[model samples]
Target: MANPGYCVKNNIYETWKNWEAVNLEGMKEIGYALSGCNQRFLNFVVFEGEKVSVNNFYFIAHPYNLELPVLCRVFRIQPYNPEMELGRTGPLAGKKRRKADYGKKLEYIIGFAEILGYYDKGGKWRQMEVAPRPWDSVYEPTEDSLRQFLLCQQFAQNALVVEIGKVRGTSIPVYLDLNAIARTHTFVAGMTRSGKSSFIINLVRASSNLKPRPRFVIFDRRGEYGALMKYGAEVIPYTEFMPAITNPDVIVGKLELKRTEKEVVLSAVRMLIEEGESINREALYKKAEKVAETKASDKTRTKTLENIKWALDNKGAFIDREKKPLDIISQIRKTPITVVDYSVDTDIEAQQRTATHIINHIKDYAMAQRSKGDFACIIAVEEAQYLAPEKGAEVKESSAQGEAKAAFIEAISQAGGYNVGLIVMTQRPAYVAKSVISQCNSVVCFRLKSGNDQEAIMNYTEYGSERLAEYLPGLADHEAMLWGMAIPTPFPLIAEMDVKEYPQKAAAFAKQAWERMEEKVEG
Candidate 1:
């Protein structure tokens, strides 16, 4: 139940023209305001059964600088009469005696229905505080919410807040509207041990259940996403893609004086190895010229050569001998779920290269499907830090994981309106390239530490630094602040994380165990 009333503004001297017309949405605001009042005002004066026709459009100016600008010139106002005194209260704790100052006229500007945004009165007409609603990828979304997400596109609303896991008492779920993910590129970032991983798991699961399910693929470096196996996602381990003599399509290549592309491919067959080498573009054109002078290689030959030389044979795998779509569509029609699992123990070069191969393959797949007709897809990078490495490290400057992540994001960001979506999740946010964040339209922010992580989040997100400063110290475990165009609001909002289902993550209290160790040491 909600309280309801008409909007009345003090600015009006004669004409109610500036006064917005009343509608259901405007009524909702009035209801909220009146419901927030004490129950004792249940029998106030005015508006019970008045037969007055209400207007529904109004102009909004900055609540602060009256002349600056209007938040929105005009929007429909939803109005409904919640009797005269809109309210409901459980038990009364205390109450303030009424004063003559608050007269009986229940008229005031209900709200800027389109700006359900957090607006501050007196701040600016266009700047009144509206509610915050963020996008929530973790939500499986009821039929009701989906319709709301689509039809409510232009509604002035805030980011949604979703609380995960619940106790009978004390633990209220945190919720954030993450509607931005659907419209633009998005990001998920946090520090190690924060709830970033758990939150990501839930997000993937929810995305899997969309109306037209999204084809989801994940880069599971530590095999953390093994849990997703049950969700029907296909896992492509390094072993499966490694070409061998047993596979008729594969052949060994002889090493040349200087590394030839063939030798590099064979060496990388076991573990896709990548180390960037400065090469001139003219050389590639010249090499193509030499190849063109001869007959164009057929598909089998091209694919085999690529597999033997490079870890990635994307298009070659799908094109036929004459450079046409293959009669057999195994590459495109197999499984919808793809998980490229790497090991935590693997060397940096190997893991980075594997991630690159998978990303390149996905990029190609999305492009191919679009040129033809195919299912739309979403590629999720779980614990992306392993693949999206930090600035060049001596261990593997060749990986240039940072550069790889940027490339991957750029490719997918361009696909959103086309036929693809990208979900990038990471525990060590700093490891993810700054450029990648701008490519995502949605985000699921879990608990994060370090100003660098917080600052990076602020740059491409709607969450403010002031809130970042306040929330950083109090990120209840895996919970995050989600914000982005993929979500609903233009503001940052909270999302309670759901990690209780992961038994592997559970453990005894650490502080108690540490205390026992200290006692033993003293003894």
Candidate 2:
């Protein structure tokens, strides 16, 4: 008996007469002769059963075995036409025709799904590595059939869900394995204003429901991530964190300072500790300056004191030196979020230095806490190039900044092992350190205009070739290409973003701030 899952199409094989001529490997070539149907590339096609049953329950009850119906997709298309015969003496008889014949036949060649496995009657997916038979009956997959065919067990019930982006065409909500993102690193690449920030905001919102609630440490370079801080993340500035730092070596090393100047600061702290002289907020700089005067030149001594004062003043007057010291690891483990805002510094290098310090501190802390078992945390770097640049780039490979950045580059290269994952988002993938981009386990890319940007993505991913790379320039707003180990196959997706899910755009706040002055005047 035929299964209700499939309709009987006795003459389906007849339409596949051209299959033998173009069938190479497992791809079947079918004629474009359907009266009302339109065939598109990448769309699913199901091979109908001639004397086979597709009902899952029917196969479960009976021991008789039959091959399951094949699911395939159109990969390529070609048109063939015969040239008209011309008189023997005609001048154009030997010339090739430039236009295609409208009446000529067109054929499409389809590649079978690279099936990893299939679900059994007992609800377990079994492994079967094979392709569809040649000249099998093929039909357009119905919506329900397509869902069942492409639907993976990972998307089924009880899995830790992270809403990635929606599948193109249908409203199917695509999900990411949150465990996978935490285990393997995720990289996001797009041009400026391509909705990368909004996509990330949506991802953070999705993560609110996870059990145990994984920790997140965000490096906000442009100060655009306040929406997350408002969502309960602890916002800390570089100078605010300075008060609690037991070792000033890590902080001073990255700040471009002369050797004598560094020793001056170091010696001051040493003298104060040895003599039991208590160093308070006001006396700290004075103690360090007194040490500089003893061995430093008059010119160098003055510069050292000025540099030390500038470091303290960098955070502006907002920071309270007497405020309780912040323990980042303990705070992250408790609140599970920490936002390092570099918005105070207008210079890019200053921001980079601060981020480098924070990342190094987090990496060391996470490694230390690993012995306690499963101490996983994620660090999201906004402008990743500064922290992890390729060799020969501007950031020196042997400098303190480079060494700090290397710690992260090394962690990501090891596939986020030791329970530390990295999410590096950049508008310029080409500028981002190649070491970081190459190690990404999964990549989410939005539309990029530059050829170099497209090429950078192609270099990192296996499925993105020059032909498909062309799609990067034409993707609709909010549309992106998601490829890598996280997905079963490379998919073109439309990101699901709800402004209500987080804060509105920064422009909205800027407008309100600008109009507030007028309100006071009117009042």
lDDT of each: 0.43, 0.55
RMSD of 2: 10.9
Report the C-alpha lDDT of model 1 over 1-523, residue by residue, as the tens digit.
1111001111111122232311112221111222221211111111233221111112222333333222111112234332223352111111344332323233333322222221232321222442212210011222232222222223123222223433111243323223334335557777666766566566555444433344556666666666666766666665344221211123221112123344333343322213332222222223433443332345444544444333223322211122222211253256556666565455454455445555566566667777675645556677665555456522343334554566576665576664556677776666676666666666766667678777777775554434464455466676566555543334444545656334133244889889989999999
Indicate the TM-score of model 2: 0.63
Model 1: residues with Cα > 4 Å off, grouped in runs:
1-126, 129-183, 207-210, 242-333, 371-373, 390-406, 462-464, 498-500, 503-523
* Best candidate according to TM-score: 2
- Local distance difference test, candidate 1: 0.43
- Model 1 Cα shift for residue 13 (angstroms): 36
Pairs in steric clash, model 2: none
Residue 246, candidate 1: alpha-carbon lDDT: 16
The RMSD of every model to the true structure, in order and in angstroms, is 17.2, 10.9
- lDDT by residue (475-501, candidate 2, tens digit) is 666667676655533333334433334
How many backbone collisions does model 2 have? 0
